[model samples]
Target: MQNMRIVKKPGYAVDSVDRALQLILLLQETEWLRIGQAAKALGVAPSTAHRLMSTLVYRGFALQDDQHRYCAGPALHPEPAVGAERALVAAARPHLEALAARVQETVNLVERVGATARYLATVEGPQLLRVGNRAGTILPAHVSAAGKAILSTLPDEMVSAVCARQPPHGGSALTAAEMQELQAELRDVRSRGFAVNLGRTEPDLAAVGAPLASGNRPAALALSISAPLSRARQIQDPAAVEALLTCCAALRLELETQGRL
Candidate 1:
């Protein structure tokens, strides 16, 4: 005769709070849940599941229908601001494109990623022959105007940590004293509301970058334009600087109003 084995129920008990919360998160992606189905899936008793659902409903994190089903409640979700970075890119793209066309220079969107500044997007100038930095490319924060513009808004300690974490292009990285001097330069950037990098990242290349803010995150985005050093000198022109400032102002307004620029 074939051996027959009987299976025994596991003695371990799952935590009720975690299970209920997991169900809540799962429901976020779904429309509604029937009591029987939800309880069965959670491996909990119907009465216990009903009590948990009642608590969620009481707190406005869930709602129950007359048909005896539950759905997510208004309090379960706050206005989503988590995708602010993507929103920032979308918000800044048109302006960057227009500016690139007008100036015939490479325009880029840059953001801080860990200890370095990473390119978020790039729009090339009118010239058929143009150099473009790929999105996700990173550079030292101290070297690039696009990096420095955003760095200028960070706290001194945080800036020091970031710079100390990586060596500068030429040597053993910036000293604390040198970091202070660089901080002074950033202060100027703050006052000027823009930063200038002349052959710091790439030889014979010059760039100008301005900051964009959203909510309490200061200088969350940087807008930049780059050109050959000779052509970059044109950035010193009063009219060009004015135009850059105007664009920065517009970006700031857009970020403030739309909460993403």
Candidate 2:
């Protein structure tokens, strides 16, 4: 008991600093937490915990609900701004280049941020005239091939939830029935072993994608190649789709084997 040395209060220190740090760590375990739950978890008085949470919220390190529950704030989990986005673009360059080289079209590595698939990296096609998509471009997830390829791998509940938050193109919103339809489409993508956006998002641009796995989770990343819809229609050879599947398979294998994705 003597070695335990519990200090209930520190002399001349910031109010509730220890408890605030503990709150941060606890929030890291989940998305959001109630103030009462946090108080109970930390075994602190509810009022004391609330005060600490208020301080954190004031600093943009946390947010509180109308009922006074707390969540990790924007400052602590800042969205990828210009600098981070640029870094992602830089890191994914080689892979995008390789995928482009293989498919002979513009290749893009994209990830869904909220309801949009933001281009993280890209490489030009080998042909003189080819579709070009650059980094920082954000497109609707339901419409983009890269978005579908990645979204197809997510759980149905999650996909529905995200789609619900955003308006779909050429429509007011996606109904539950429509979301289920999207899920069906994703299942087909999983069955076909690839995702295709046939000018769904952009006119005269068509693309296909395969999943990139990370650990037990599969398709955390996606590799997609895009070209003019007219050219894509002419090159509807079954072998080409097969080749894209092979690339996805190889990339997944390489990522797993190398312990990185």
**lDDT for every model?**
0.73, 0.70
Stretches > 4 Å off in candidate 2: 1-91, 167-172, 214-218, 234-236, 249-260
> What TM-score fits each model?
0.61, 0.60
Clashes of each: 0, 0
Residue 124 lDDT, candidate 1, scale 0-100: 80
Error of 2 at 39 (Å): 51
Off by over 4 Å in 1: 1-85, 166-173, 214-217
Candidate that scores best on lDDT: 1
* Clashes by residue pair, model 1: none
User: How would you encode candidate 1's per-residue C-alpha lDDT over 64-175 as one tens digit per residue?
Assistant: 5424566776556675532455577788889888888777788888877655666777788878656564354557677788889888888878788878775322235678
Error of 2 at 23 (Å): 39
- In terms of lDDT, the poorest run of 10 residues in model 2 is 63-72
**Cα error, candidate 2, residue 7 (Å):** 53
